[model samples]
Target: MRLNYPFFFIFFLFFINSTYSYSADCEKPIMPSDAEWNSWIQDIKEEAYTEGISKKTINQELDLITPQKKIILRDRCQPESQITFDEYLYYRVDKSRIMSGKNMMKKYKNELELVANHFNIQPRFIVAVLGLESFYGKNQGKIKTMEAVGTLAYDRRRSNFYKKQLFAALKIIDMNLVESKSLIGSWGGAIGAVQMIPTTYLESGYDFDGDDKIDIWNNYLDIFASVANYLTSIDKNPWSSDSTWGREVIPPNNIKDIYDSLKQIDPKGCGAVKRRSVPKKLSEWKKLGFKKINGDPLPIRDDLEARLVAPDGIDGSKFYLVYPNYKNILYYNCSSYYALSIGILSDEIIK
Candidate 1:
């Protein structure tokens, strides 16, 4: 799976709770006295030492230990179910974000290009991810990652995932990629301008700026490029600049025929991710009575393997013919609806 990319904290929890022992129910709230905090801090330091974390790192992280509501609110505020696409597109993808991205593009053009060229991905795509993730760092999460991860680790609903993230965060400290004291980020552990979690920092982040540290928080170049490289590592073809990330289309009434034809083929990652290998193109979709939202023929790409995706259920208002690259965007965030927002927003930004 893509590791809970939707809210980002869940994936963060996956890594955050690996080694922590639950103390109490976080919501009921037992304000650990200064002495108690100190005791727990020492215990945490011992755990870190056992895990090979340095004394310096443990001390640095322990220095900042006051609790805040921001982290708890993030988990509690997660939508009970997926918000409808209309709501997501209307609220999440706004003109302000697109304008901000354009402004940032102009400001950081040279740096973004260099990073994209080095990473073999598009600068716009990287920019889109930044905009979506944190509005280009406007709201880079505020919770101390160690604390947030620790809280979730103790929550038990996703104890295992949070524990792993906690372990990974410790590893990050040990690696010296980021300092343990530098716990500035999303309500989750996503740090820096691009807002990568510690685990993601370990996996996809790099010091493109040659600053001797992969410091994405302070450096725009490192943050921008690291986000691009992360996407490329997962699937390079999705980074191609030429393609649109699927479109809202109108499909025929009898869409089941196409779905049935594709189901006979047992596929691994693609279908599970909603990428059905429909061996057709614009021409076939048109032939099957598909029409563009604007009531015109879709521009043809005969050779490409296209999938008929109704992001809403079959009876929902819109139909989409998603390409494999669009599926790759879904890899960026697992929800079909989330992917749809990014795809549509990207097209708007580029256009």
Candidate 2:
């Protein structure tokens, strides 16, 4: 059908306005000029060579590296770190993840048990880490690992840390554990089902299946064993299956003064570290009027020392008498919210 001239003109104007409005709303991120990016890539390639990366691998990977503005933005706007404890827990330890973790526990019962027995780590905690890290391997991220690390290494905000990771990633490729182009992971460069950074992968990843390749991306055995190994490795503090992560407690009225007297500013650790009460024997806490959330007597072991932690501060939320095992969780991910969610989710999975 032939359109009228007036109608055609009106339709053309509407299309143009809509297109321009959308473009304005979704403007592209500003990035360095091509010449600057190219020069940076060349410098990275030279550094990689001095660090003993093969010339062929450097050319194949570093030559094509480009700045990932999207990743830089993501690093700057990490919503998880900014959210409240309750909000973080609600999203991270929801019903679906608990159910999925339980199903995974049942499905991998034998393997989990074997790894647990061998490493003296709890099977449920292993499963919880897997669920939290990649949703039972359902979402291991889609960004190329090399590109993400390389971009962050050049971005200058945390260059020293990301550069270390970038070099470790190069070593991973050089050793042929995974091909550079095939390695995909989070925007910050954490890889595999357990979301391990490159340094951790090199230090603790194991070839559990004895297939000669530590393929955490595809092998559940490797993933589970690797996580257990990381927690129980000799260099790291061994996880004690007999001890729990912590118990929620009610502190005495003078807890604030007590906390102030004992608190140490540990800037290198997680948020929980800032609020950690001085370590006291379980009996001392009980004597000082702290009790379990359910009002039960604290354990009578004088040798068992624990720090009282109130993640949302003492007045706003439940307090916990966190044991060494709780700190072990922080070794995996320093966020107290992340560690608490894993512990809570693991308990549900076992139930």
Candidate 3:
């Protein structure tokens, strides 16, 4: 029943079909006419009513909704979609972010430990995710959640997905989880310090601080606990407290051949999971010439399996051998670039 989905799916889902840009020569895209927009709003209201949202809430919240051009444009031109893996990592996991993450770790040492102990997630990782998502609560976006999600739901690209998110946002308001006036978040409708989409918040958010409200926006305790809880929400590969996310690996000279031979298809999960190589035991990978980034031998563990992920490709200078815990992080954001940044940041901040 949890509707929380990998946020990266939205980026990939939209980018899969077309790439939009803001160049001067680029033709301006068409917007829906008022009449068209109104009809869609009417249909959405009926659907919301059918979905069991109170008539009062629907009438108050959806009456004046309109498609937002800014939200549509923001969705179309995310920087991660266009950048190289190195470039993306460089910006996402920079020195400033690392230092801030460390400070946050110290500042919330006690609270983080409690959340970590309760949820069995690494404290540094919780810090890393929040740091990346909203700069440790300093910048959790200001766009009105209803308006942003409504716009996305109306847009042709990823309409079904956003429609679900829009309704989830409404449900939150109807449940009195967060008031309509204060329901603000990212252009993509991701709320709070951890940048959870409405569906994710509804499903995984917790009132850890016991304030009677799950305030991921301002409460650090709730934010930390919510993140830890969400990370461990994956049932098949629940986070392993005994293991770390993954490490950078030095691949064999014939990594391309090795990659082709070892690659296996995943029919389930998002497109990101499908792009990674099949999981192989650490021992098997070691025998095939995979080593620690520092040229050390991989841990002698035949029991553990890891998947080789080269976001840039075999030609890229860096490669990672990701463990199951990495997939847990992927539940938050499906992209390897995003997950790797969290992994590396988690290590750096703790050091």
Candidate 4:
């Protein structure tokens, strides 16, 4: 999801791609020479074989790999990278998507409840992620997984990170989890209904149906369970089913300076938005005049800590007091806009 392009270059490419279109002949604008590309593949093959990938897989999958110009272009032109929070929410959490998610939850109620109970994750959260990632498997992407990962591995900007993913993808093929030819995903190598990267799939995938294979692409049970397992996985920040992601609130005018002074720049890869103040007990925020948008008192739980986030700046119409569960959603996708959309969409589905 995160590629290490220089920040300025990313904005420059976005600007150029938005302003103009390349002709078909100019589509592949940049590529290494054949000799150079072949040598890189040879090196990858050697490393793959030494790591225990079968010779057949190495020869069949790696030999035919070529730079996927389309993937590089897609990576550089992500609309979500440039859109406003309101625009992002409108596009991703529309009425149609909410309706589809509701139907999906109703149709799969028994299975969803089973997985939710087993994993202690909310069913709505799982369904929301499914809807956001692939429209409930209706658009699981069309690019070949190996080809996409291989192309990024050779692109040089984030080669080392993507090379590791390429290896993980080959191991998936070697284990017969999915055939090399049938393995498909997004331009960045995220796969299946949940759009997990190869490393995430290997780490948290579950065979919920007990068929002995984790088929996130085709099996609804496995897909749901795998998603739940991932959020609850030990390697991730812990998710608390006891808390909601966040609540909309109104801050008192007298507290403006305190809130403004608390703002901080988000770490790289977190998102472009400014982060909120460091967390404090919910009780403390209540004493400072934060209240629910409905004018109710803030929750009186002494054990809970939260941060105030106003995505469009302090004067923005939307303001939220977010909890740890909100941060957990960020692990699934780093963007605050992305996490907020998921939370709002999940709430709509539950309603």
lDDT of 3 by residue, 269-323 (tens): 7756776788889998899999999999988898898998888877887899999
Model 1 earns a TM-score of 0.79
- What lDDT score belongs to each candidate, Candidate 1 first? 0.67, 0.76, 0.82, 0.79
* Each prediction's TM-score versus the true structure: 0.79, 0.85, 0.88, 0.87
> Pick by lDDT: which candidate is best?
3
Q: lDDT tens string, model 2, 132-239?
A: 778888877788988898888887877988888888888888888876666888887888887888888989888887777778888888989988888776434567
Q: Which stretches of candidate 3 lie over 4 Å from their true place?
A: 1-36, 77-82, 265-267
Best by TM-score: 3
Model 3 residue 266 distance off true place after TM-score fit, in angstroms: 5.6
Order of candidates by lDDT, top first? Answer: 3, 4, 2, 1
* Shift of residue 119 alpha carbon in model 2, Å: 1.6
Clash count, one per candidate: 16, 0, 0, 0
Ranking by TM-score: 3, 4, 2, 1
Locate the minimum summed-lDDT window of 10 residues in model 2: 1-10
Please identify which of the two predictions, 1 or 3, would achieve the higher lDDT against the true structure.
3
RMSD after CA superposition, every candidate: 6.5, 10.8, 4.4, 4.6
Report how far residue 280 has shifted in candidate 1, in Å: 4.1
| C-alpha positional error of residue 209 in candidate 2 after TM-score superposition, expressed in Å | 1.5
